[model samples]
Target: MSAVLELTGFVLTLGGWVVIGATLKNSYWKVSTVHGSVITSSSLYENLWHSCAEDSIGISNCRAFDTLLALPAYIQACRALMITSLILGMCGTLLTLLGLKCTQLGSNSENAKSKIAMLGGMVFILAGLSSMVAISWYAERITAQFFDSFYGGTKYELGYALYLGWAGSLLSILGGIFLTCSACKEKHRDYKYAATRQGKDARIYIKQSETVTSAKDYV
Candidate 1:
């Protein structure tokens, strides 16, 4: 690809990753903490009153307030956003790879810078995956505590989407680890097409060699 196109692809993909990561951080740490605290504090009063202990039942300000209430709304929103970001990232990665190929990027290619660009995308994917654990923990808590409370105080059952999101998050974590290693891999070899020219000592030669490139080149 031309310099202009290459630069554009890198900027878009990198920026998208940043946006997704920022969203997750804000939702999990900032929003969840403040809101979660309030919910927990309120629930203590209710728990004290509703439990088997008779003395604490009629105490003032005994209304229970479980943090799980604040937890679900935010968790659901975060899950939606995360799923969207994953799809978006996949698209951006594919486009970036195409652009790199256009610029003749590959291990043996003259324009090897494409490899680095690919590695950059892989890193972004890894980042997304790493955050999944934090998100999942929070999400599961929200669903189990808050959602289940609605149906006669039974343990809540996660819906299909919730389960899918959980599964996807786990997969993303694994994928990120895989990609991180793949991106750092240097010296990868593969078969190269070769043809022999007729001569006195003509013989077919099969070239097997590795391509070494840095992650930065893809960008």
Candidate 2:
């Protein structure tokens, strides 16, 4: 059961990273509003690195951001956070692979494997939080822009990429939690086994001492 849970968690964490990567690269995190009540409308879509506009005729044009320094603070921050999360997720995946019981890397002892798994879980948690922070920051900015009354209101609506980011964040968090729980259970079992062995050894030693004492008295 533990193995299943750990494996599921690892898979979910890996999938979450894939989702986040796609979200970051996608250019549809937001889409421009349609002015007409028409069923079909042309709109602009944008992501962290680029923006694309589509016309009613289905022609599309895309432009990448010219410079990182010229980007807004939120954009810069989101990019940083997302990249950091990706790096951490990669590290965590590596650690989780090593920790797997079927693998030989840290399989010398159950304790070692558990510790490695726990470390991976910690990394996953950090990665998840980073993703969540970036997404929330971007969402907050979008909300503020949308509600702005003083200036031209936000012309965009929340798009698919943002939803994907949210789903990925949730998966990472839940998977990390499962992995952490497995690690904790393994640690507890190790402690219990050690205590039982210690008790048995102590009993055997006491019996030996008593036997020697009785033999001495008889002699």
lDDT of each: 0.42, 0.86
lDDT tens digits by residue: candidate 1, 44-144:
21110121111324333323335544544544455565656566566546535543534444454522444554455565455455445435664466456
Q: Best candidate per lDDT, number?
A: 2
Best by TM-score: 2
Candidate 2 lDDT (Cα, 0 to 1): 0.86
Q: How many backbone clashes does candidate 2 have?
A: 0
lDDT of 2 at 86: 93
Q: Residue 182 deviation, candidate 1, in Å?
A: 2.8
Of candidate 2, the 10-residue stretch with the lowest lDDT total is: 33-42
TM agreement with the true structure for every prediction: 0.35, 0.92
